[model samples]
Target chain A: MSGTDKILLVDDEADFVSALSERIAHRGLAVDVADNGLKALDLAGQNAYDAVILDLAMPEMDGIETLKRLLDLNPDLQVILLTGRATLQQGVEAMKLGAMDVLEKPARLDLLLDKIRKAQANRVLLVEKRNEEKIRKIVDNKAW
Target chain B: MPWSPDPRWRDSDLAFFGAVTAGATHELNNVFSIIEQTAGLLEDWCADPEADVPAGCDKILNVTERIARQVQRGTELVRRLNGFAHSADEPCCNQEMNDLLENLLALMERFAAQRRVRLVFEPAGAPVTLTTRPFILEQAVFLAVSAALAGTAAQGIVTVQLTGGGAGVEITITGAPALPEAELPAAVGAWLGPPLWNLEGRVRTAARAGKYAIVLTIPKISEEVP
Candidate 1:
């Protein structure tokens, strides 16, 4: 709804998260970063975000678990999994578990932004579809 | 299963190597990501059509270029690590000793810098090519450097030299005062002791005045079956 989208970045590497946060901010997006998966979930609970960029190999709770928890809290949440261990099996598993997409490590900033935009677009479509369903159900009840 | 028949030892060794290699590569990836982000920021700044050109853009570009070079160095270190991992399967092979030493130095650069120890490498007359398991040789060198650093004071210099001789290739590590006897961990000594003693080559250490020097001679080929 706002001009700039809100993005939450979660990774164990401090330097990487810091640098990426700065770069995303430069691209006119409001960015919040967490050092690990637990901190990421805490942040997700506190704020509403347009999308979350998560790292797969983290200490406390891994990306898959974190995504599950975040989605349970808000089913509409969009998640992008970023991992250095880009195994085919893991990628497919993430997508099956409701991740918007899986990206490899060292992904270009522009490419990440594009994925985020698509995720956001998908979120909008889902909401619109739900509203349409609600209207159709109301019309059916009135006719009966 | 008998103690000797169990596969645990091999599994543990594989796990240890895998963890170390993965951790090192992950750290290197983080370094590259930071450099990329910094360069992207500069490019964005330069591309701002409405904004005025900032002062000292040239200096920023120079610094970013330096960071890029460091990233390349990190990538090379990872490549060396990959090579080392593959070398485990090859018991013996022909290798350029100088290149191996350089790669080892690069691999340990961050560790040395963190400890404030200077690593100096002085190669012999010409590049010495040898047939050996370079990974094992690298492990020996790493252990020797760690020992030297532990013995040396902060900001001390650890010098590594390679020389060819009648026996084979001699790798020497020289540093400040000898490491304290109590500091030598038994496991490390055990891992290094047999190879240093049983191999045709010899590993010798001597206390000269106050400083210490460790010399390791590795033969061009193993005496074991081909």
Candidate 2:
């Protein structure tokens, strides 16, 4: 939390993902890119990322499946889904499946950053709330 | 509507047109998808109202405009398709060669771009109007163009010229690579005469000055009957 947040970006379009990742990194966040969902899940397991930005229409374990696997590994992980064209149904489905946010492709960099920041903040709040609850329970117990 | 009539004849033409339109639209969709992704990236950058104006904005705008042109090109294709469909309904009519070429060019532009080839249309002295089935004329022109385009390389150019002559109107397609006389596709050379009524044309490979040209000629009429 003190240093720049680490973000995992998954997209099949290399040129698009490369440009986006560079732009996001320019905004002071650490970004690691994976071209497919499987690699993204592998990276998620290997690292504790602040958030994951995923694209839905990819070959071999798409964004939705990737999201499920990432959350399964770290249930508190924050994720944002990226879709192409005007897919409203997929966006809604992504949200229902615990995605922090769903964005249309060719999305503005600022908007993506805003969502990333918000998701990271919420993750921090969730962790802090759990810590506070633990402290309260400890104080009420006689066993140290 | 008649159950007695041959069902194959009823839907065959329609089905072929549909398939051609769908293929063209699918290619157009891919182009649009690239543009959409780039535009989304630009929008992401501009969302920060207070962020310092970046130097990349100009580049993004240029790409977006290019994408817009492609989308417009796609729209023109749909229009051409509608015209082509209507032409089928009125089989025999006065067909404007220039207008038909224009429509064919619009539809084939993206296809040419995809293959990295260039298709150029050169008009003669004046518009050569002929009395014939527009759809049949269109198919002939389309086939000729498709053949010429297929032979050319990605960077090659296929020139289509509409010239006025005493015998009739000559539609010449030059710049196609010379295929060995033996390699000509059997179907293309099988002499499928005038796919439409009142239209007489031939697809033959002629060599002039050591260059091969695929020429198609359709005779023009002076007037139309009531």
Candidate 3:
């Protein structure tokens, strides 16, 4: 629990999300599932997640829209997009939107795990950088 | 003189086919993705030494059932797509309107899902078989439904009903208007033009305060014109 990476898995498919989340948890990570972008947003707002796994096509709000809103909430959030078919243009758009990576659906477990690990590591570095910046700002403003 | 289909119409037809195929394949990918994950989960369960055998067996069985359901879903999607592809085998053929509309609805489901709208097909009780340009008739209905969908807001219902009469069948598509009254005619025309011309069908639209209906009346036997 102390060092486990926590992730939010957002997909509209119940069985897919459940099985993927279970397998991911078995790999020594903590996973929370959301069936839609709105639920994912709620969870992301309330918790500090190392990364987010988002499906491209969903009801109400799509992955691109969700990515924008999530980034608005925390520009430092590491988002890994999953799509059934990731076109070149879509990949470029997602990268431009600050997604950590784009993965095709039916993603190999090992490959997905690798991306998740990288995302977690990258998130930790961002957090550390932010904390150091906070310390530097405080020191610069100190009276003593 | 030989009759050639309008190049623009042909292009639109191809685009429609491509869109349906892409959507169907995407759904198939989702189905397979679930099956793959469920299989992986079962493997993980089996590999756990401390896991109770009986509990693990139950979980494995449950996941197996999930896989079966996904397979069935994938099979049905493929079947529908096969039918849709074969729909172009003949420019004109004998067709049962109910069956044709059902297949179209299933294939167009992805479009409706994207729009967050509901597509309700109310099939005519009796068989409405006709000798006509079946593919063209289907295209016309497809366009009419698309227009209805465009005029419907998110979560709204677009209903398609079939009614057969003396010499033709009437396809009525209705929905709550999300688009302005003045804009609907042009929008409907843009979608329905080529197909309606080929099918020799007539479209009559009625709009009230909240609801609008687009009715397409297609003759039972349409003589293909050169």
> What does the interface RMSD come to for each candidate?
6.6, 7.4, 1.0
lDDT of 1 by residue, B44-72 (tens): 76788754436767867665775777678
- Chain B TM per candidate, please? 0.73, 0.72, 0.89
Please, what are the lDDT tens digits per residue for candidate 3 over residues B1-226?
0111123433487766776688899999999899999998877877988656565677677888999999999999999999988888888777888888999898888778877899999999988777677667767776677667666788999999999953788988888977786667656666677777877778888888888888888886645423
- Candidate 3: regions farther than 4 A off: A1-4, B1-11, B224-226
Ranked candidates, highest lDDT first: 3, 1, 2
- Please list the C-alpha lDDT of all candidates, in the order they appear: 0.71, 0.66, 0.83
lDDT of 2 at B141: 64
Per-residue alpha-carbon lDDT of model 2 for A65-107, expressed as tens digits? 8888888888888998866532577677777888888877556
TM-score of chain A of each: 0.86, 0.89, 0.95
TM-score of each: 0.55, 0.53, 0.92
Candidate 1 stretches with Cα past 4 Å from truth are A1-4, A130-144, B1-28, B50-76, B79-226
Top candidate (TM-score)? 3
lDDT of 3 by residue, A12-85 (tens): 89999999999898888899999889999999999998889999989889999999999999999999998896
lDDT of 2 at B82: 80
Top of the candidates by lDDT: 3
TM-score winner, 2 or 3: 3
Write down the TM-score for model 2: 0.53
Residue-level error in angstroms, candidate 1, position B61? 7.7
Question: Could you report the DockQ of all the candidates, in the order they appear?
Answer: 0.16, 0.08, 0.72
Clashes of each: 0, 9, 0
